[model samples]
Target: MKKRVKQPTADVPALDDDGPFAGDRQFVGALYRGLEILRCFRPTDGPLGNQELSQRCGLPKPTVSRLTYTLSKLGYLVYLEDSGKYRIGVPVLGLGYACLGGLRIRDTAQPYMDELARHAGSGVLVGLGGRDDLSMIYVACARASSVVSLQLDVGSRISLARSSMGRAYLAGADEAERTSLLQQIRAKVGEEHWPRHEEEILRAIEQVRTRGFCTNIGEWQTEVNSVAVPLRTPRHEMPALAFNCGGPAYLLSRERLEQDLGPRLAEMARKIQTFGST
Candidate 1:
């Protein structure tokens, strides 16, 4: 007798769900599928063929072909004829840089991030979440030591479903906004991998809400840990930004993080938030 193999299931939710953009049929489905294709590229996959993309996105080969063609035509992706693969295109980089230029949060928070890095002897990052999206843009960073380096840089984009900074912001978001963002992330990354750390993530968010800070242990990057605190403007309607300090686990132990570094980060967040008012 042969052993059975469990087939993988579609991880995304049904488009008919009464969440996010509830009744917008064609627009939502196409948008979701297109984003699914682009997300197939990762830090590792240098470039990928239509076949690989199809397999990864769980879309038909013809659909992947059409989507890639449209993306190439729109300048969001480029095709390599010889190798028959595709990679992120130049226009996206230009747009990303342009967006970074417009964000003033980085300028306001740089000094605070620098102070945190200096005092804590760790790398610090300040980021702002996209208003209607489940992603965060790293606006500022200050590195204290050369031993540990986070691959992320200023202007780097990270998913809200997987990052401490993103989660802290989301945890602070209003009920309706948080639900919408969660729906979008699930629609994009699917349920399986998207919810890999659901319980832990929820707990982390609650802790952030309760303690006014958030900590992540080997969640986003293996062997690396981080702590973050939210920065809110005077109105306190949304988290205007967030700041975090991170490094190798050896240097970012829970005891030091809670006792020593947490207060410094909280103080920095307050100063950044206050500065944003002026």
Candidate 2:
């Protein structure tokens, strides 16, 4: 048997890839690199060293070191003495809180999400998310009263290709952005595995067009089932977000998702959009 070698993927794209802003004179590369380093830290990550940060951000180790040091000095990152690593600090939390605070939709959507979660009964979780790179990041979440509910919470990231929430977002995206995002997902998953993901996404998008929502059954997580609807905002700057209702397969059956909760969520999204406009 031969050992397998991993291929390069889009998750670690080069920092200097020329894009639409490549020729812009006002773009600050240093600031961009510093922000990229901060963005690499996930909700579940522990304090990370320069080597790990370099790998995640696709920057040279020396570059990551300088950026991390600057960030630490600015109080955006805190250095761990024993581990010789850096963790997101208090300033980052203030930024995150401020960002969330500015999103008035989270407040508007939470009550509806909670009602839907309860309507779907225990073991069901409802969430609202937006695209973050190749993943969907939960901005708000609600779970029915149950110790058995999924452990996901605000800031959790899930698959952008296989999750119902992600498919819903793709369905709502403009043609150019959708194409670009799908290509990025394919690049991240590699060519050999892309066909299956592409097929799933296409089917879900079709569902969103014909019906009001899309579903995922045993796709992202083998035992999780979900349905989602896209939420196009009145404000153009906000981009589109998505809402999902899902839980363990035993609790959320395919029939229930497609017939009951999916339609309900779609209706909720419609109401929210209408309210936002007025």
Candidate 3:
């Protein structure tokens, strides 16, 4: 077995406590910190130690140790003896699955998304995603391209400021939420690169307003092209969601996305939202 290499425990920024609820007296800091520890594990991460968790979460190692111990005992994290690290436990998976299961739109939208993808052509993929902090996490997926499609699945995440799906979501979000998310994105990207991302995001919002869909052609990835539309959730409190049809640039030309798939995806969103509300 390949030996696990632990990342250096320096230079990681601490968790920002500037959220809207930071000043709320009712907010449980310990509970929030524990959840933040869970959020640090991404789809591609390996088991993490207290040192890494401390750096990632901006918590002291001792705090992380206590949190990890509590989480491990609670079955939210599993400690590994060999690596001296923790991986997300089965109970967390159960919670995720339970959340997904409650989103009725996933079932109501899949058939329509699949049909739309087929009409878009081979190599194309259809995805339904919702905001996950600074990213959009796919909650449902469909593909028409049997042989080759974007290497994404239900749990894959894409950049919220770059992806068409995420931009559509931004367009659909309430003004306050959108402003907060943009501020977070600006902080993440830094002042040096914020202007370009801001421009692209603004343009996407305009496209959605005028044309009912947004396109990301060779922007998020140099060779990928996609079109997306905002989707309405059944409840107001739910996070904003979007649907995207995308694939390799060579297979999905800008004209085709703009003139064909984009409108169809928007129509699909309309129908699904109608069904979802009832």
Candidate 4:
């Protein structure tokens, strides 16, 4: 299994565009497989061979070969002639830049995100659920007072069902959208533990609706806790965004975070909403 210790260092995530289609009449199998191949390359996974791609994508070696060939020809995947492996290529970058350039959240939320980081002496970030991966990607960020292992930087991706940011995004999303997102998340959790996981996420969603924010305590990362609230801006596009503040669990205990920081986060979100509305 890939280690959860992986943390992003850069402000930009690895790619652009959206995730693969679920079940649609228009769903193209070839396109979905191509995307699956691209998804296989990660910051941790690095490059891959045909066999490994087959294993990760659950596709046959022959099919994988054909897809990789097509992708390589399209400049979406570059083949390493010597290593006999494939990695992401440049055209993917164009998609990411175009998507990111169209966003306004970072411009409006940045100053406040920084201030919250300083006030809480913890990392503060704003991100949205990716239409591409179902993960939330940080578009704006503020570092904590001290150096820490938590990797909440710009372009860093967080889980949809686990992180406070993710829960906030889910809570803010409309019913049809939230249901679709939850179905995707439930698949990721798998069958064995999904029942319990689903209940916990439902409670968090309720809390966000009633109490104004959500909390993450050693859920996504060990010994880390966070508070988050959903943000609603004008235009309010798909993959609705949210804000979160987090630090080591040692520094921000569960009780302290819920009692103190939680309200603060809700207030910050409201302020941002007001700021966006004007």
- Candidate 4's displacement at residue 127, Å, is 5.8
For model 2, what is the error of residue 29's alpha carbon versus the real structure, in angstroms, after optimal superposition? 2.4
Angstrom error at residue 250, model 1: 0.8
* TM-score of candidate 4 to 2 decimals: 0.82
Off by over 4 Å in 2: 1-21
TM-score winner: 2
Candidate 3, 52-152: lDDT as tens digits: 99898788776677778889999999988777899999999899899898887899999998898778778899999998888899999988757888999
Model 1 / residue 260 / CA error / Å: 1.9
The residue-level lDDT of candidate 3 at 194 comes to: 96
Per residue, candidate 2 scores C-alpha lDDT tens digits across 107-209 of 8888888888889998898999989888898899998789898788888898889899999999999999999999998888999999999999999999999
Q: Give the distance in Å from residue 72's predicted Cα in candidate 2 to where it truly belongs.
A: 0.6
Any runs in candidate 3 off by more than 4 Å, and if so which?
1-20
- Show model 1 residue runs off by greater than 4 Å: 1-22, 25-32, 122-137, 155-162, 180-198, 219-222, 234-240
Total clashes for model 3: 0
Which of the two candidates, 1 or 2, achieves a greater lDDT against the reference?
2
Q: Model 1, 1-278: lDDT tens per residue?
A: 22111233365344344333667664566667777887777655688887899899787666677778778889888888767788998887787677667766667777766767777664443334443255676666787766556767665677576777777777767689778777777778777866665676687778787777788888878887777776667654334566677777877888877777777787777777776777
Q: In candidate 3, how many Å is residue 95 off?
A: 0.5
